[model samples]
Target: MGDRWHIEVDRSICIGSGMCVGHAPDGFDLDSARQSHARATTADANEKLLAAAENCPVEAITLRLADSGETVFPPED
Candidate 1:
């Protein structure tokens, strides 16, 4: 979980939940509409950030390897 990752939030499905913000404030932000957005498009891996993605009620958050584009969170089946 130390590799760089690219983060994305699916606003279409985002229910404006702040769980991501609560789980990883530095990794996520809520817009005026309350939809979550990544604080940065790319960042170093961190447990909190992974937790934010994992805890998202609608699975809106996604993380991928910055270099390989491999899925990191909501892992591939």
Candidate 2:
């Protein structure tokens, strides 16, 4: 981890929900496969990004902290 929050989408779990796209268009997009993917590894961790994570109905979006490599969103089980 590089001291940046990296957002990850579990595409297998993704239900092709475009909520992530609407929340963080700059960061996420649905591929031809209809799965959410980050344009780049979660660079900014801004409000939109956080909201995107929160918006996922399936909770597929995961934000991993850089320093501790801890998963932030979805509340780590």
The per-candidate count of clashes, in order, stands at: 0, 0
The TM-scores, one per candidate, come to 0.95, 0.87
Top candidate by lDDT: 1
**Where does candidate 1 stray beyond 4 Å?**
none
The CA-based lDDT of model 1 is what? 0.94
Candidate 2 ranges with C-alpha deviation above 4 Å: 1-3
- Superpose all Cα atoms of candidate 2 onto the true structure and report the RMSD in Å to 1 decimal: 2.5
Q: Judge candidate 1 at residue 68 and give its lDDT.
A: 98
**Residues 1-77, model 1: lDDT tens digits:** 46999999999999987999999999989999998999899999989999999999999999999999999999888
Q: What would the per-residue lDDT of candidate 2 be over residues 5-50, giving only the tens digit for each residue?
A: 8888998899988999999899899989899999987485578888
Q: C-alpha displacement of 41 in model 2, angstroms?
A: 1.6
